[model samples]
Target chain A: MNPVGRIGLIVTVTAVAIHFTGVAYAQADFEGIWNPQHPPRMGQPDPASVRLTPEGQAEYESYGPDKDPTLRCLMPGIPLGLVDPYPLEIVQQDHQILLLYEHFHQVRRIFMDGREAPDHWLPSIGGYSTGHWEGETLVVRTTLMSPDNYTWTNGFPYSGDEDAYVIERYRRDGDELTFTGEVHDPRYYEEPYVVNGRWNFAPDGEIWEYECIPEFGGIQ
Target chain B: MLFIGFSATAHHNGATYFDISTELEHSDATVVSYDLVNPHGRLVYVFMDDEGNEVEWRAELPSANNARRRGLGGDLFRPGDRLTALTGSPSRSGANFMRLTRVLFANGDVAQITGRNAGVVRAGTE
Candidate 1:
């Protein structure tokens, strides 16, 4: 059970906060300053990504969806790399915005500068994301993500390691901004997986300083 | 401190604490180096570095082929088939507790280790 789910206030406060942002938050407006938070809860499961082959099913069954190796501050590997349950700062400059997740001091620098991705050797974690603006929407295509699907403790399997791609269409509809992510992993996936995630920009906040120290336990 | 979550977690590399690094400068003990005696049964232990160079140590760990030994990834050794291995030591002088992150051999070879079992409690000189 989610700790904050009991409060009921977080949902109200978060929704109200999103409501006050006026109209919708466009990509350029959100490019400057933003704080991201993922409270502990079982959000909507993307069934589109759930369709896997027998081998893929085996991998996903090995662990639950929340495979948090970093629970004890262990090494954070593929998947939980960005979807950490904490507030992160998103700093946008020109076409580039930096995503800094607080789980284990992990940060990913996304390039909006239209450069071609390298050869077939990029490993997935956050993957390689390049963004482009279409009117008020920021369209980002992320490739090179390592495929397996148990980032923390959850054992959800992505389609495949080599052929997975995420097309994130970020739209700011007034105070409520929506991020529609499409996952395409060809090996195990028979079709394109889609997820429409929504968020509110918290300007009245600061990204909490999170540090993971596992030297003694060496858990991280 | 692993965090738990369900569906929709971006399946990327979960954060590991190895890179962030810790200060680890604790002033809790009055003296620095204290002897570590085993609280459990006797243990045959050896202190090895990353290069597998055996360093002089107090505890005695058993052989790798021992019936009670378990291997973590990269040749890390564990006793009792669990992440926490209780090696053979004398009485309690101090404790050498370690997380199951990595283990070093007498020849200085290092292996991955984890679990919060390596402890070194401070002991007042008898």
Candidate 2:
């Protein structure tokens, strides 16, 4: 190769290597068993603060406790799973981060390899999560969530379509971890629904198995 | 030690089945059976009413894993075990159902099953 070409190639490789090294050093250590400081509220938004669309209001009014997905042993999904009262273990890796929850043994994978969601990806309870580090905070964006029939703590209904998305920021400080999330569903709400929660590091905490059995007899 | 507080409406809506605003106490209750299962634990017992009728009731306790963390074992209560006082919230629909909060054994031991007073199981004097 020519001298100029070799110089340009060496400079490009060095810049890419420095960028990756910076990301590695800037990554915060969130690896630990975290116990929620407060009981899980199932990502319930205050009805007074939430401005729902006409369709959303109708769905909310029609919600009943019997329609809860958890009663049928289905995963609560996304923000609900994230804020569950059970302990969760965060396993950080180069390509992805794994969130192992004790609530029904749900596992969430947050890809950090800069891959975009596929066009024809199937919607699911946990959805698809892509995470990137911004300073010391881990920012996660999830999309393509299935609109399962479930009611929030205050009877607010989840009626979003596949376009519904959630953005979360996880910040770790010492032994405390704070989380803030915003749910965006233009079809359901006029504004993004916001929620906040916190967790404390449990050095001796361990995730226990959660076995759920649906009570068909009790379902009416 | 991390103490996970038990919410009455944790898994499902407690208000739909339970009259959470009121508390009921059943004295001298006899255990019919105890099932340590998921979603919630079931404690079936029979108690004599004011009319001298033996009425069977079902009390929903915390999940088995939560009970274990609170020092309660699967074999804690067996059939025919006598309880001095079994306290909980009664069903809103007037069914034979309850949301268990505490259990006082005949031997003077106390087990605070749920709510703010949970996680305390005192030794019996006997």
Candidate 3:
């Protein structure tokens, strides 16, 4: 082969590699502002139908909207914030995924770089997330959530299991994103509870501050 | 027609405090102020009762961000602006707590302020 032809072949191969590399990184794009196509209800079986354990039943009976921490301008926590009515923005990077929720101005981080969650960690509102891509789907395992957080605004509380784990699956299509979560709480729930929601890609939407100040007190 | 005649409500424990199945009769009111806050917003206004006594009513709304998306702001209703409001039933029988659904200003302007749940006819449009 001529020397000039050999150089041309090398250049062509390099260009192809670069093009495919870009596509590989782009295959798992979850970056965008999104809102549910239809507003989502809390979780499966309705609160009226949920079979709570004795302790959970008592907590359910005693709790009311007045006792809701959100009334005090506190974070709604984990699954609640995940499906908040306001728009949510997802920013993806090589090693991390950042979620900015317009509600409560909550920011959540999901580690993407092969880092495992600590065996023992403090509880938090958004909890600790470690995510990996399964084909086009993003699967996240979150734990260490604050026990004080209620699963729903309607007074249904989580079982507060220190080992309570939440598994969430996120998938994105052309203009739609779907999220499904499973709460494994052996302490207070008769069985694993499921929560699912759908969000559409909102290119024109922007996240806004939902500052919950303490001064407002009518419903609290 | 894909999106018409459908009402969307924001995320809140509405069923916890308000009767989702009941709606109050439309009332004639004069606006006092608009409280755009988190968790929910409140519309403060007064109306004349059947006994001709002044009654102050507080109507709950969606969060400020939802309201902003719906084109509602603190300046939408002035203190003396006369409006007809369609409200939802209150949890308490006599309490003035109600969910503001639609509002019609006397000046030929009709605005539907239903949060999360919209698509109802404007109060005077029907």
10 residues in a row with least lDDT, candidate 3 chain A: A18-27
Across A1-220, the per-residue lDDT of candidate 3 in tens digits comes to 8999999999999888766543223247889899755434633346666667888878878877677777788887775555667788999986778888777888888887667778676778778998878899988888888888777777767755677888899998889888888777777678766777778898998888777765553462
Which residue segments of model 1 deviate by more than 4 Å? A1-27, A32-42, A46-49, A64-67, A72-82, A148-152, A213-220, B1-126
Query: lDDT of all predictions, in order shown?
Result: 0.43, 0.75, 0.71
Output DockQ, candidate 1: 0.04
Tell me, by TM-score, which candidate is best: 2
Q: After superposing the true interface residues, what Cα RMSD does each candidate give?
A: 15.7, 4.0, 2.9
TM, every model: 0.48, 0.84, 0.82
Candidate 2 chain A lDDT trough over 10 residues, lowest sum: A38-47
Tens digit per residue, CA lDDT, model 2, A1-220: 9999999999999989867653333379999899867534434454588998898888777766466676677788864555666688999987788889888899998888777788878888888998999999999998877777332544555554766788999999999988888887777688877877788999999999989877621323
Q: How displaced is residue A207 in candidate 3, in Å?
A: 1.2
Residue-level lDDT tens digits of model 2 in B7-30: 354333565556666677888999
TM-score of 2: 0.84
What is the C-alpha lDDT profile of model 3 across B52-98, one tens digit per residue?
Answer: 88888788776777777777776776678787654555554447767
**Candidate 3: stretches off by over 4 Å:** A1-27, A39-45, B1-11, B92-94, B115-126
- DockQ, ranked from best to worst: 3, 2, 1
Q: What lDDT score is found at residue B64 in candidate 3?
A: 75
lDDT of 1 by residue, A1-70 (tens): 5777757878888778766642223346764334332322212244444676677667656653134445
Each model's total of backbone clashes: 84, 0, 5
